[model samples]
Target: MSVSKKKFNLVVLDMAGTTVADGGLVEQAFSAAAWQMGADPESMIGYVRATMGESKISVFRHLFGGDEGLAQTANAAFEAAYGERVAAGLIVPIPGAREAIERLRGEGRSVVLSTGFARVTQDAILAALGWEGLADFTLCPADAGGRGRPYPDMVLAAFLRSGAADGVQEIAVVGDTSYDMLSGARAGAGVVAGVLTGAHDKAQLVEHGASHVLGSVAELDGLLGELERSS
Candidate 1:
């Protein structure tokens, strides 16, 4: 299926869940970090879930604000824990993830893998999936200059890097969280697609500003088709 409409030339996708199969690893990492930092169970869980697609440090700031030392400590611990978990080769590309990306690229659409992870972790994920060079651009918060998801830094970075600055009207942002949808909307991306293969449900995604809700990244072609026809 064609994953584009009249002018969609870029598809910015999230790392975990959208491109990579998460399998609850992100939640587990957050829980471990929260516990290690002596954060309150209820509040930590709430904040982590609430900010599912933002940077890990961003989530830490939300959960353990006012205490930079503690938040930083917890952040390091979370990265370490997540790194270990992922290094064990537990992570894989979501089913159809490779196909979706390949198909999109084959059609000459620029594909960027944008994530909440640090650069190191993002590289690790790409390596684990044997997709080290698959994406035309692989980016994270650090690469964005400032801020992360729920903000447009990452998506805008994609726009600039992919040479879509003037063609922002042809950009699409696809991820599994409200943060991704909100970010895309903020970036003025013509297509903001939320997939249900990760942390969010359809209702949650729609509530957050997703113009298209997909079953998973595998259905990206369908999403592009629907949005195009609706246009």
Candidate 2:
């Protein structure tokens, strides 16, 4: 499948595994959350791993059989555990991630960082990385009406809030998870790119909906350049 290139003015990037290296903190936190909720961590780990970029709350809701109260409590536990890890400096920006954002912004693009974690956890990550205002905007599921990856809501919200592109086809979405690719494709982004620094591999990413597969977020600027040249 050949994809025609177009210049994108809005860039929506996934947080963990794509731009931030959380060092498997998500699974660790999920295990703790599950145990706290009287669920077997080993039994739930597979689903947790499979839904890497989906909203944590949504994952809990599924795991808890649609019991909203249980899901909410489990999600709170997960967020607290994750936030504590972030506060402990367990997370780091992916190599050259900050530089890539700066380069895109320098080239007149608006960059928005989106994540499946809650807002509090997202803020903790930003605070840990000292990236309080690095991107034009930061988003979590709650900010986009409680939907995350595999849904177009957050991407669409970024597109609507940034006012960076005239249409969805002028937007670029990059992440490391298949869910992220699906979200981008569903949102009709011009460039639905998958990076290899996170959970899912190239095949899974492409299988879901990635238009491009990159080695890492660092390569994104080059991808955009290549697209521009082809255009």
Candidate 3:
């Protein structure tokens, strides 16, 4: 692939399943909310998984059945349940993620996080991982300006925040979901690297146009170095 044009000084990462396994937290929270509303737990989990990468309101509506009032109530219940469990220690960064971030920063790349979760939740994950100030910038769904992943809004927002808007050619979007891959492609990012550390598999990532797929974030150090050298 176009290695020369794919060299990037900036790398944007996705939080949640990519950086941390918050899917468990999400499922737990949704189940509790659904139970409170007398809904089936299994059904709620299916609903939540389908609505991933969307807004909180959308997720609640999809999970607990879509009346605005029910959605609002469900959202509050889910968040409360999630917050309590998060406080009790459920979220943890993926293996070797910290080392990968440190290595990238040490190599002079500007790193940023672009997430579907709220800023508060993102902060909690970072804190849980003890990864304070690890990234140059962070972009949450709220900061995404009405567009979420599978769209390019959040990725582009992170790029702008990292001072890479004018140099989009030198940015790579590394994520673990097809939403991340499609988002990067739509944003015109030169390279989009998908990892198997999150929800989707290699075939899914490829189907969504991921430029490369690796086993995990830990493999990033070598692959990224190779990309730079080839560039």
Error of 2 at 92 (Å): 0.7
Q: Which has the higher lDDT value, candidate number 1 or candidate number 3?
A: 1
Query: Could you tell which candidate, 1 or 2, scores higher by lDDT?
Result: 2
- Cα-lDDT of candidate 3: 0.75
Question: How are the candidates ranked when ordered by lDDT, highest leading?
Answer: 2, 1, 3
lDDT of 2 by residue, 110-229 (tens): 899999999999988998999999999999999999898899999999988887788899899999998999999999999999999999999999999999999999999899888888
* Best TM-score among the predictions, by candidate number: 2
Candidate 1 lDDT by residue in tens digits, 111-228: 9998898787888778777897798888889888858999999888888877743577798899999899999999999889999888889999999989988888988966675666
Output the TM-score of candidate 3: 0.86
Clash count for candidate 1 is 0
- Candidate 1 Cα deviation (angstroms), residue 46: 1.6
Error at 88, model 3, angstroms: 1.2
Q: Tell me the deviation in Å of residue 82 in model 1.
A: 0.6
For candidate 1, list the clashing residue pairs, or say none.
none
Instruction: State which candidate has the highest lDDT.
Output: 2
RMSD to true structure for each model, in Å: 3.1, 3.7, 3.7
